[model samples]
Target: MFWKDKYEVGVELIDNQHKELFNRVEDFLKVIRSTTLGEKKAQKVNETLEFMKAYVVEHFRDEEEYQLKIGYPDYEKHKQIHDNMVSFVLEVSEEYEKSGYNDALIQKFAGRLLTWLINHVAAEDQKIADYAAKREGI
Candidate 1:
């Protein structure tokens, strides 16, 4: 997915992290859509998956911190969304491993990641931004 300027929430740290996430996800999609298959594609996919596994947790932590700092009332609900995503990623990673690195599983995982990231940033994260803006009178 591409990061658009409109996605910015006037929070430099969070905005940078969000941009990095979009870049990583876009790179991941490129690998998945590449003509090459098997080991070559799998290598890139594995790298991206590993990055996502770690980066997502870090990003969520930072985002949650921002929410708390702003006294965002929906902090719990926002956290639940992050927790669910973490769980989904872990579950899918385990299933992918058990399935012997099945291509189909990876494809499905990528598709869901794309959709989830978009909605989370565009819909969910925006709510946090709106709350911050109102409080800051920005």
Candidate 2:
């Protein structure tokens, strides 16, 4: 349960997506760390990776839309961050496939993913919430 109430961006859609991301990444970590057989673990990892690719894109799209709606001052910078992450995920997935679903690569990817999610939700996304709050005088 890496997700915390404090990490919420005060937007229902984005907050829910954040929670889902946390859950997915946490599941990924558990799978990689488990005593599951190598084949099963690799299969699960591949599934998770595919899900993340699609879900992350959808979530970012929605979040960016919200930013645009509110005229968030950092929209461009924030979107660039999202774009970079998407590219990273795509690049990693490609590498993971090329490596024949190597365990070491996925293990490393999971760690980085968790760290990025936590930082983005708790810090970067918080800025959006704060800006929205101030604008609304909430």
* Predicted model with the maximum TM-score: 2
Clashing pairs in 2: none
lDDT of 2 by residue, 31-129 (tens): 789885677788888888899899999999999999999889999999999999999899889998888777678877888899899999898999999
Candidate 1 lDDT tens digits, 105-124:
88898899999988899889
Q: Lowest summed lDDT over 10 consecutive residues: which window, candidate 1?
A: 36-45
User: Model 2, which residues run further than 4 Å from truth?
Assistant: none
Clash number for candidate 2: 0
TM values, all candidates: 0.94, 0.95
lDDT values for all models: 0.87, 0.89
